[model samples]
Structure formats: structure tokens, C-alpha cells
Target chain A: MSITVRIPTVLRSATGGAATISATGSTIGEILAQLASDHPGVQPQLFNEDGTLHKFLNVYVNDDDVRYLGGLQAPVADGDEVTLLPAVAGGFA
Target chain B: MLTLTSEQRDAMVAHCIRNLPNEGCGLLVGSDDGVISQVVPSANVADSARVYEIEPKVLLRTFRAADDSGEVVAGCFHSHTHSDAYPSPTDIAQAPDPSWHYVLVSLRVTPPVLRSYRIVDGDVTEETVTIR
Candidate 1:
């Protein structure tokens, strides 16, 4: 299945400034893997050494957060749009 | 520099004040020139006075709207309940977009202080915030 991944501003450098890119996969993990493979710099940003989704990153397939859709195991279909956004978080402490 | 209308600035302060005790957060929608057209208040999903997280749904919706409007999610703002208007260590560590203006509102003072910064690769640089 072909999917479109929307690249956030911070990750644009890794994608050669492309705002959106196309990849093929049936699940979120596969799509991300293909993304990292195409853009090696994105690998470390998207996954941890243990291959878990980075805690600070949010992945959405369409409007649904993948975390609520079984995380990396979330299934996707052709023409699905996957968006990666850095969790906007911070504190005084 | 980050430029915002005075009313936009007040809206951010008001949202932070409304979420008192817990930190407030929001997204900034604007052009590439740093002129903010909208200040979108969001729920601090973290719900902690010391920290904040922009609700995911808000983020998604803001991004979609910006995409459709030809504007961009230029940056974001959050409140510092007890500290000064500066990027905290947590803010630096989690600074997502280097091109984004990281705005902070310090409610510790009367008439809450608002400031903006550019955090890149963990380095924080204070920027001028123009509220007209």
C-alpha cells in the first residue's frame, strides 16, 4: 500500500526539505521503517535503540493517533496519510 | 523576532490564567516572517503546574487548518506558572522545530510576562517579542 507521510518542520532537513514523501507499507511500523531507510537521519528521531516509538513523537494515521490505534502495530491502507509531530511539551521543573 | 497583536498576546495570557495551577499550552499559526495571525490555546494534557503538553487533537487540527489556509504552524506557546519567561531545560530538550518561535508566559508576575525564544540543538536564544 502506498502512504503519504507528512514531515514536520524539524525533520525537514532529514527529508531534504520535502514537506511530504511517499512510502509503502501495510502498518505504521513498516511505513516508518521505509521512511528511516530512505532518510537515515530520521531513524534515530523516530525510534529508540530498542526500536520503540520515541516517547516524544506522535504518529497519526489520518486523524487518529497511532497510540490509540495499537501504536506501531496500527494497520494502514493505501492512500492513508501519516503525520509525524513532535509532542509539544515542557515545564518549569 | 516574533510579532503579535496586543489582543493576541492577551488571549494567550488569559488562556494561561484560565488554566492556573496546571500549565497551559497552545500553537501559533502564522506566516514565515514570524507574524502570528492566530494564537490557538490548547489543553496542557500533561496537567502539571511544572510541565505542559499540547493536546494531540489540538495539534492535529491546527496543522490541518494551517495547511488548508496556506499558513504554517509557525511555533507554540506555554505558560511558566512560577518561573520567569524563559525556555526551561525541559523546553530546550524537547524543542521540536528550530524554525519555531518558542513563546513563554510567566504568570508568576502581575500582568504576566511574555517572551519568545529560538531553541536550536539545545541552545536557547532570547528573541524580541513585538506586541503591537
Candidate 2:
């Protein structure tokens, strides 16, 4: 199944100028794995030394916020979208 | 015009602080009345000098899903990695759809601080951010 994973500006370098990428997977974990397999640089940005998402980062299965659902195991189907948003911390200077 | 509950306020602060050194940004769901339901972190637009912009698709999805969830788009929350909790000229100029409670999360200072506001045209009014 094809799905779109939107990349936030902070993580754009890992994807090399791509704003969003399409990958294929049946489940959320599979999709994430595929994304990692496709973009080797993206792994550290999304996961930590423990292989878990950084506390400040969150992934949503079509904006449903996987944390509220089933987390990394959240299901995904063809045409579904996944957004990986890392919590931001900056403001007016 | 709205108030955040204790839990909602805390969640936002924690999310902001956890991402220190870089600008942390995110979208807050739940109506003004239900301000504690959703807090999805977003990108910082990669510029420390400008007001944060919610990612286009992420922004759309957050608000759209919130609408579908029967919740009003209350406002958006972002942090100040190294400044006071106040909106800047960029924030005032780029303020979209007036009803949003432009929540400013302060991470530069200790104990952390949060202030909510409504910036329209150029007026900035601070609102009490609380959770109940």
C-alpha cells in the first residue's frame, strides 16, 4: 500500500530536499520500517538509542495521533497518510 | 477568550521543554471549552527569527481531524526556546484566522511559563492559561 509521510522542516535534511515521501506498507510499524529502510538518515531523527521515538517527536496515522490510538502499531491502508512531527521550541527574538 | 485546563497546560509545557535548543512547535486541538484533548507537536519552520508556521499538511490534518472529532479549532501552541513568552512582529503579521488562541510556551526560563493570547491586526491581549 502506498502512503505519504510528511517531513517537518527540521527533519528535511535527512530526506534530502524532499518535503514528503511515499512508501508502501500494510501496518503502521511496517510503514515506519519501510520509511527507515528507504531513508537511512531518518532513523536517528525519528528514533533514539532505545529504538523508540524521541519523546519530543510524535507520529500520527492520518493525524489521529498514534499515542491516543495504538502508537507505532496503529494500522494504515493504501492512500493513508502519516505525519511525523517533532515538538518545536523557539520564538520571537 | 479561552482558558486551558491544568492537564492541557502541563502537557503543552512538557512537550515544549523536552525539545530544548531547537524551536519546538505544535498544534493544539479541542475547543476553547475542551482545551486539553489534543496536543500534537509540529516543526519549527527551521528559522529561529520568524514566527512558527504549522506544516501545511500537518496543519490541515490537525484542524480537519479536530473538526471531525466534533471539537472546535481552539488555538495553536508553540514554544520560545530562548525568549520570553510573547508574540513577535512576525507573529502579529502572520496571525491566521483570528479566533485561535496563540499560545506561547516559554522554555528559556526556569520553572517554564505559558501565556495565551489573541493577536489581530496588531493588538495583543494576554489570556489566563489554565486547566480544570
Best by DockQ: 1
TM-score of 1: 0.96
The parts of candidate 2 lying over 4 Å away from their true place are: A1-93, B32-34, B47-51
How many steric clashes does model 1 contain? 0
The digit string of per-residue lDDT tens for model 2 on B1-132 reads 556567777887886766566666777777656355777777655544344556545765765587578785566888877778898776665555356678887777888888888876679888766555
TM-score (0 to 1) for chain A, all models?
Answer: 0.96, 0.85
Q: Rate the local accuracy (lDDT) of all candidates.
A: 0.93, 0.70
- Retained true contacts (fraction), each candidate: 0.83, 0.23
RMSD, each candidate, Å?
1.1, 11.3
Fnat score for model 2: 0.23
- Score candidate 2 by DockQ: 0.11
* Model 1 per-residue lDDT tens digits across residues B1-132: 999999999999999999999999999999998999999999999989998999999999999999999999999999998889989888998888888999999999998999999998899999998877
TM, every model = 0.96, 0.55
Question: Which candidate number would show the highest lDDT if scored against the true structure?
Answer: 1
Error of 2 at A80 (Å): 16
Report the number of clashing residue pairs per model: 0, 13
